[model samples]
Target: MTNVQLGAPNFRIVSTNVSGEASSRALFGVSYGLGMAATQFALIPLDDERTLYKAAISALWTRFETENGVAEGRKLALVNVRYDSESINTFFYTKVTTVVVADVVEFE
Candidate 1:
């Protein structure tokens, strides 16, 4: 149980429960061995969807982390990006992009 300090009105602290269903999903993907990574696409509606964002995300990871500890034959592929729209405030909106990274047995 990790305690996270999220500053608030009363300066309340919250515990991070990774065992919850929400956090559990982050542990795996389509297949146990498949790799994935993701990031937010835009603040404005670039209208980026999962199918379109996959290629960009994959390229970004490879170019930046080609020398990672992964094996020679194992490369990171852009599995998909999760797009979410959140209404944090009445006058403004937030679009969250979650990039998923995974290790692959085969290279494309």
Candidate 2:
């Protein structure tokens, strides 16, 4: 039960694939908890829908590091950093967001 930090060169991107099934990438290295969330608002019917959610998740991770100081400027390892997205339809196409939550851990 040891505490680990982020920013450590412990994680590495293994592979990335985009297809009809699912677009995702895999990372190899240590294990750690990396939680993320994304949100977006759309006005026009046809527009770039991926960028907004990506930005949101990025911001969420940044904030998590800044606030929790889990892996801030430290050699912490991470693996299998996955990304997923969903839509929230209410009144109108107002917003969309995505969240990625993972754990960074090292095996003994």
Highest lDDT scorer: 2
Once superposed on the true structure, which residue ranges of model 2 sit more than 4 Å away at CA? Answer: 1-50, 70-72, 105-108
* Candidate 2 per-residue lDDT over residues 19-97, each given as its tens digit: 1111112122111222444434344444344554455445555655654455555543444555665544455433333
lDDT of each: 0.31, 0.41
How far in Å is the alpha carbon of 29 misplaced in model 2?
A: 40
Evaluated against the true structure, the overall lDDT of model 1 is 0.31
Residue 7 in candidate 2 has what lDDT?
Answer: 55
List ranges where model 1 is wrong by over 4 Å: 1-52, 59-65, 68-90, 106-108
Expressed as tens digits, the lDDT of each residue in 1-108 for candidate 1 is: 635333644331111111100111111122121123322322344343544235444544554345444333543232223332221222233232333333332233
Worst 10 residues of 1 by lDDT: 15-24
Our tally of clashes for model 2 stands at: 15
Q: What TM-score does prediction 2 earn?
A: 0.36
TM-score of each: 0.26, 0.36
